[model samples]
Target: MYHTWMRFFTPGPAHHRLGLVCLGVGLQHGTLPTVGPRTLDHHVAVVVSTGRGWFRTPDGRRTAVTAPALLWLTPGVPHHYGPDPDTGWDEAFVDFTGPTADTYTELGYIEPHRPVVALSDAGAARATVGRIVRAARRGNPLLEVETSAAVHELLVTLRRARADTAPDGEQVLQALARDACKPLTVADHATRHGMTPAELRTAVRRGAGCSPKDYLLGIRLGHAKELLAATELPVAAVARRVGYDDPAYFSRLFTRRVGMAPVRFREQQAHTVPGGWSDQVPDPDDPPIIGRTPTG
Candidate 1:
């Protein structure tokens, strides 16, 4: 016999614009019966946290499903799976779909190609599903939005937990981020990491879903944006700080990518302080003193 708890939702069309909406979530354990060899129109992420099972492909190949694994049931994909009759398995699943689901698939976060992915750990993903389970309470006003957001988090958590992701690729990504403002070419970065340019490209694409050049540019541009918004630094100085020595080229690139000239973006994003402007950033650990009278 199997134990199961599940909730399904039909969020309004407006909720679909949130980029990802949760259609359902479930938790189950014990000797669950077999599921269909039928096709689904949406995606479901079935996370098995314990025990073992087997999955049958449309081609009729049966693959073992071990604990701490993810089974991706994608649109139009036929799936058949069940826990072992003797041992059973513990499982949590989230069904989700939206335009962003396509984007995520392209980014390698949702792997339809590799349906049965072994996970290094399922704890974090299970915790995220637990949040969805709690939010599934009937009559909750924020149900749609809360569960939708949690679905996005669950995708990222699952991606990170995949046992196939190379630790070296993760290190390469971290190194690239650390030196994003170093004004180095992709080849130079590759050399620094003791990898050939092609190897670096492969690593970045696998780890970040982008080429090394694009990844570095994204980091540089992000830092430029923060500087533009938070500091009064001149455009040329900002350019130099983000690895572009030529302010004109920087302005053109920023305009093309951000849809605004740097000066215009700064003007639009300038922040005003409650009192006279101060450059000091507040410590996040300190609690805010709310409703306090202002001192002269």
Candidate 2:
């Protein structure tokens, strides 16, 4: 008494090397039959968009599943679930696996412990799955690559839609990014936000998946790379711009993290624009070249 549309794929080794591959995707509704208390080799993200159900782990603990909710069926984990017999439920699922899945799990994007996650909204996630569905079209040449990319987007969208996420943590991340180049210590930044240093670390770790110091360093070094590659600014000036008062320390830190000296990175990444380096970036809305027509 259920309607289901699903497609499974066997991606080539090259596609698997892309860090994530789509194993399958499906959309289902109505009073679907119960899923087994079986184990899987890969992972599946079962997004319940409507109605209700219950999920059971290997330990036989059953948790209520209400829309919009997400269920993570990780590798080697036994899972069992079914819709409420009377009401049924609408569900969309994407199965994926690759080396990067482990990294994503470590970063908290894929929660193995929290099997069933309540989501604030499933629209975005459903839309991403829709993209995968469209890519699943018969005779589509880009099916593997396109669907694989959508799986990455789906993971990010689901993480953002988690119901337990706090707005304050996001606000703190935004504030930290805005003041990333202010030369403030973690303690200083925490004080400005009316939070203790430990609290700041917790907030950043929850929000950005890293410590406050590491988050700030990531922002600072990213900007430094842009300046080094796009501008003719001296290394010292670039360091200062990114909040490193001591140029030598900045270079050392940059090398340690970036795996090469800044100068060497610049030499490898420097690009020459058609009109040469300009301090002002052109507005997207502005006409293509002052007097030239854009070509398709």
Best by TM-score: 1
Model 2 TM-score?
0.89
Error of 1 at 40 (Å): 0.3
Clashes of 2: 0
* Model 1 alpha-carbon drift over 4 Å, by segment: 271-296
- Cα lDDT of candidate 2 equals 0.93
Worst 10 residues of 1 by lDDT: 272-281
lDDT of 1: 0.92
Candidate 2 displacement at residue 139 in angstroms: 2.2
* 20-133: candidate 1 lDDT, tens digit per residue: 999999999999988997798999999999999899988889999999999999999899999999999999999999999999998889989888999999999999999999
How far out, in Å, is residue 77 in model 2?
A: 1.4
Clashing pairs in 1: none
